[model samples]
Target: MKAKFLLPILIAALALGAVQAWAQAAVGAPAPSFTLTDTKGAAHALADFAGKPVVLEWTNPECPFVKKHYGAKNMQALQAKYVAQGAVWLSVCSSAPGKQGHYPADEWNRILAEQGSAATALLLDPDGQVGLAYGAKTTPHLFVIDAAGTLVYDGAIDDNPSTDSADIPGARAYVAEALDAVLAGAPVPVAQTKPYGCSVKY
Candidate 1:
């Protein structure tokens, strides 16, 4: 009986440790490399984009915080601008199947088309491995990896952090600022910030 009880406790502790281990990606350091499949079932690896700046956007289409940016075209505009300059913008959804924000591939493709999304790919993270590894806590948690593969920025997209589209007009777009500074050979003014939005449904 004692051995049986100890086994359960040990399992729980190991699980917690695994989560902590996966969340070690830090700013100014090499971002964790990952391989995830896009909606079309094509696998892409972070290492494949080496020598180019990359943006990892954690998104939940049904989240109001995400809607605030997309509805205002702020996110797409950012994607378009940076991608035009050779940056790879990846939109990742960590919602598990049967969850609130989860959608099938057909629905995901349709949603992208309907929303005029400009992301290079819609990565499906149904198991949430990518999100957990990045320590993404919010629906719109954003990360920017420079050409050197260093995570130059990680956090909220903007300072407003509200679910209102009107807030975009005056908010400090952190992701854009980071991208500009990194691309210009300057250090990012803000390397990290507490992200705000709906919790990523793992």
Candidate 2:
């Protein structure tokens, strides 16, 4: 009887996991559309950027892995580089109201200013709807959407998953590689990889 009960629970859990995976925008598939409010109380929608490439970054200011990239200026540099090239780079935060990374609008703006963030906008996703749609599971999870609204990449920021800023110099930036390929009309070399960082607070 115990074995029978355990099997059913296992099956249910697997089904849920599968559903979550399917809900995410798959590589080569149309990027899932979303509308989110920024810290400035302005609402932005994916469709607002119809003909431009978009970069989605899952960020939490308090996560150590996030700090590793930011402290190295690695993430900020990418934001500046890509956004200057006419891509929409959006930083997303999905931490719940009482969660570790959650912060009010004023504090959020202050932090972004201090970090010199260059993303087009810092979108708030406190309800986790956008994160869940993208299957964002890590503090530094990343996604790249082509100009045609196709999701070309979904995974870690770089090849190395270390929390050391020193790793930034040596690590291959998967997001940058994919965007470069997309812009050049070439196939993305590495499409996906398991993300590594603190679990997203949902």
Candidate 3:
């Protein structure tokens, strides 16, 4: 009887895991579209950026790993550097309501301004629809979509995983590198990597 019970439980667990795995977006596939409200209360839709290279930054203000990048201006500098070249940088907050990083829209903007964030928009994803669609797992998960709406890159912000600003200088910036390759019509050397940081509050 115990063996029979365990068999059913194992089957159920495997089925659940399969569902979750299927929910994740596959690289090289067309990115899933989303319409999210920005920190300014303006609605921003992924479809609006169809013909431009877009960067989606899954972030949380309270994550120490995220703080390491913003506190050191590493993330902001990257945003400024690329936005000047016509890239649209969209910062996404997928923290669920009552979670560690959950905050009101106004508060989100306040924090971004205080940090001098260089993103074009601060998008709110409190319901986690967008996060789930992209299979974002961490506070600083990064994704890049090319002008054709194809997901060109999905993974960590850089090679360094430590919560140390000192490591930023030596880290291989995955997003920047991927964007450069796409712009130059070259294949992305590292299309994906294990994303490291706090688990997204969702």
Candidate 3, residue 173: lDDT: 92
Model 2 scores worst on lDDT over the 10 consecutive residues at 1-10
Clash count, candidate 2: 0
Residues 1-202 of candidate 2 have per-residue lDDT tens digits of 1222533554686877843342457988999999999999999999998788899999998899999999988899999998888899999998978998889988999999999999999999988778877878899999999899999999999999899998888999899998898878799999988889999997
Error of 1 at 186 (Å): 1.1
Report lDDT (Cα) of residue 26, candidate 1: 93
For residues 35-138, could you state the per-residue lDDT of candidate 3 as single tens digits?
A: 99998989999899988889999999889999999999999999998899888999999887889889998788789999999999999988777887788889
Scored against the true structure, residue 46 in model 1 reaches a CA lDDT of 99
- In model 1, state the lDDT of residue 140: 94
Q: Which clashing pairs does model 3 show?
A: none
Which of 1 and 3 is the better model by lDDT?
1
> What lDDT would each prediction earn against the true structure?
0.89, 0.88, 0.87
Q: Please name the candidate that would achieve the greatest lDDT relative to the true structure.
A: 1
**TM-scores, one per candidate:** 0.90, 0.90, 0.90
Q: Across residues 75-185, which tens digit of lDDT does each residue of candidate 1 receive?
A: 999999999999999999988788877998889999999989999998998887778778888989999999999999999999997899999989998999999998898
Error of 2 at 87 (Å): 0.5
Query: What are the RMSD figures for all models against the true structure?
Result: 4.9, 5.4, 5.8
Model 2 residue runs over 4 Å out of place are: 1-22
